[model samples]
Target chain A: MGKTMSEKIFERKVNHAVQPGDLVIAPIDCAMGQDGTTPLAIKSFLDMNAQSVFDHHKIFFVIDHNAPSPMESVSRLHDEMRSFAQKFGISLFDVGQGVCHELMVAKGLVVPGDLVVGADSHTCTYGALGAFATGIGSTELAVAMISGKLWFKVPETIRINLHGTLQEGVFAKDVILFIASQLKADGANYKAIEFHGPVIDRLEMDERFTISNMAVEMGAKAGLMVPDDKTFSWVKKRSKRDFESVFPDPNARYCEVVDLDCSFLTPQVALPHRVDTVKSVEELDEIPIQEAFIGTCTNGRIRDLEVATRILSGRKVHPHVRLIVAPASREIFLHALQMGWVEEIVQAGGVFVTPGCGPCVGTHQGIPGDGWNVISTANRNFKGRMGNASAFIYLASPATVAASAIEGKITDPRKYLR
Target chain B: MSWRGYAHKFGDDINTDYIISGKHKFKTLDMNELAKHVMEDIDPNFYQKIKPGDFIVAGKNFGCGSSREQAPRALLAAGIRGVLALSFARIFFRNAINCGLLVLECNTSPIQNGDEMEIDLLVGKIYDHTQGVQIEARPLPQVMIDILQEGGLVNYFKKYGSFRGV
Candidate 1:
């Protein structure tokens, strides 16, 4: 029996071959906690009464979820985080840096074959670079911070091969939404999803991140794409960290294999309240929307912004709709500003929030009102997720959100795309 | 470890948001306070109705969504002895163990709402006394059960100390 990419990653981390269902103690290459979870982790660390962290450089505390301090209490949490970081000499990315996962990848902290763990579930996002990353609780993270090693039950791998080219208007967001629809919410429970084939090769690194970011919605342990030249180029431009490329064995055993042809895919939308409740843009009714949001860790990168910029270039947002644009990271925000994408989006009546996890976690910024139907490019549309249980949220691509912002309703992006 | 409780049933995909609403996340960090609102959205009286040593039984993918440990923490605070589900999200399972909450993956829903159940973690047995059914759940690894026996990972670390880091 051969090994999958994640299996190989665990093997490298543990210095031995691992199979699915095997429980092993693997050395952690990187561990992180965000503002939403870090305070608890810090508390756990203190409760453990440990003198110091295992490795200062390998651990990180990011203040992104409630970036810029949503309130005085939250600011106090920030102060606590800073004090903890300073006390332990751990890396701390303050407010406005970016979401933790994005910062980790952009800063070159996540290399191929690295064993990464964070307190946030989307920590699986780093698996896009071929690293075996998964989310754990704050206590587990605190344990990692104290000991630098954690136990893992190596997960079975489910291979998904994409063959056909993504049709126009059908962005990477659509591909992931389509996959989620097929898998339902719990389809991949406790399994790692590995993407393969030419279509995955064609997706940009940012696009791959978008796919892996949503893997949690399908209950996957990790969503992995083997490192290729594209991944190498992205990492090379970001950091000078030395790394060895990782790939699965030719006969790597998979629990199951799913074939997805992107050619037939259209811009997909996850209906209100459930990610798996998906419908194509054409098949859905044109329901009016009170708000449209185009940003988040899932679809707030430079390329996504450019897509929004292209759709909103010559037009203004509808007077009735409130459109919010949030760049995933400050680097992406600066790049958008330099490229004039920010200016174009602002001129088209899109309000820019801070370059953090804006409105995605729903703890801060641009929350929708009661009974309002809003379209967003964020990953989850779970009830009460956007700070309001009465409000409805629809998930789609940045282009679809931008077009809907202009139309003040749920409109397909293909009509707006040239 | 062993537990005897009545089942409080829930359906599939009971996400963390429903477990402990984000609306109350910033209000306080008190686990007991958050327990007052556990599953408030799904069952407005869930917190009020839950008794000490109650067991939460659910369909597949229980505790799915954002890795807010509060979900499991709230259950522990609310005196939920264990959660028996067809499956669970990965983070929730780990969090449950760390928080000293028991989670068993049952191959079937052997117990329904209000049914009396007893679980023996050491023996990997679930006895649905009300339904007169017996189910075998995957036994937890000895390491994890040891940690749980120590009242979660923090206590385990306190007693055993931690691994030296590089």
Candidate 2:
């Protein structure tokens, strides 16, 4: 049988033909741990009594989860991470650098056809560049740091073909939310999803990143797209690394095929406590929100900011709502500032925070009050996701969030769109 | 090896966020401190109700969301001997195995809250002492068994010098 994208990537990594369900120990191109997981990984690394990391250049430590140290205890963990990074001579992306996954891709640390792993679930975000990336636990990350190699059970592939153009104000977030509704939480357990068809090809790198970032929400090991000219140019602008892109054979064997027509899709929202409980924004009743957030690894890119900015430019935030905007990285933040998107957003009563995962991870900054409702563009909507189990989180597109912020209710972005 | 515990049953899609909330993640990394808050959102008194060697029984998709190892670590610290679910999110399943916490997939519907249960790791069987019945569980692969036998991946790495059964 012809090989799928993941199978092809694994075959190349191991330098042998492989099939689904085969376990192979392959060298990892890059491995990372964020502040939330790194401390535990350091503990496990010491517990293993490892003398040194396999390679300093291949491992990274990022401090974005609880950036700037919300408290003394978190600060101590940050210090521990800094010390470990210094001792091992590994690269450290300190606070405000951005979310770990965004920094990894923005820095070009990962490329097509490479095997990558991170200690955060959204590490699957890198698959937008066609890399076979997935998330593992801190202990597993420790193993990767020591050996630069990890074993994997080659997962079967699920091919999702996206056809047609998205409607006005609908975006990659909507597409992913719609998919999540159909697939549910555990739909793609232990499997890799390869997105294909015209819609995927037409999507920009930022949109692709948003889609791939949420693959983990569907229980996918990796959500990948075939690297095309756009992907190549995007990576080339960021890094001078020589890399090869892998694609599935024409007759590739997929366990299942899902075809989605994006033309019919509308602004989607995942209600409180469950990502799979998605509905079209227009179909929902007047669900008032106390906060509207536009940020995170999922939708914190420049394009995402531009969309939110366009919606909030002249209109003030609703009296009952707080609009918070955080760019995915300092680079994106500076770019948005140059474009005047930040000023316009802030002028419209949106609060701009440091470019990191603060409110999204609920470490510090902008957490909702108890019994409040929040509309966010972040990926997951699991119970207590935003640090307050009593508060509710609704997942939507950046445009939708901005619209909702303007009205203080779950409003469709198309109403604001010209 | 066998483990006996009272089942602390829960419903479907019990994500890691519900297992341990994000608010507590930054407050402390001490497993014991985290243990006190384990499942606090789902059941406020969860930690107080379970004794040493207890089990968490739940429906489908147990331990979904995020790659936080703290979820399993906290459960282990809270004296949860094992988790029996209809299924698990992929990352959580691997994390549980890496932490040396027992995770089994079976028809957890047959298990009830506070039921006395025993799990035979070698035989892949769960005996519900309270229900007076037994159920078969999905068996772990030899590699996972090897890692779990050593009380987690770190110990397994210390003993074997590399991952085995790959």
Cα TM-score per model: 0.97, 0.99
**Which residue pairs overlap in candidate 2's backbone?**
none
Model 1's lDDT to the true fold? 0.88
Per-residue lDDT over A1-418 for candidate 1, one digit per residue giving the tens place of the 0 to 100 score: 8889988888888888778988888889989998888888888888989888889999998888877776787788788889999988998999888878889998999988788999999999998999888999888989999889988889998999988998888898999999999999998889999988888899999999999999999999899998988999989988777888679989999999999888999999899899999999989887899989888779989889999999999799999899998788899999999999989998999999888888887787888899999999999998888888788999999999999999988888887786
- Computed on C-alpha atoms, the DockQ of candidate 1 is 0.57
CAPRI level of candidate 2: high
Candidate 1 clashing pairs, residues 3+ apart or interchain: none
Residue-by-residue lDDT tens digits, candidate 2, B1-166: 9999899989988989888888897677799999999999879999999899999999988988889999999999999999999999989999999999999999998888999999999999999998999999998878889898999999999998787778
Top candidate, metric lDDT:
2
Each prediction's Cα lDDT score? Answer: 0.88, 0.92
TM-score of chain A of each: 0.99, 0.99
DockQ computed for model 2 against the true two-chain complex using alpha carbons? 0.85
Sorted into a CAPRI-style docking class, model 1 comes out as medium
Off by over 4 Å in 1: B107-110, B162-166
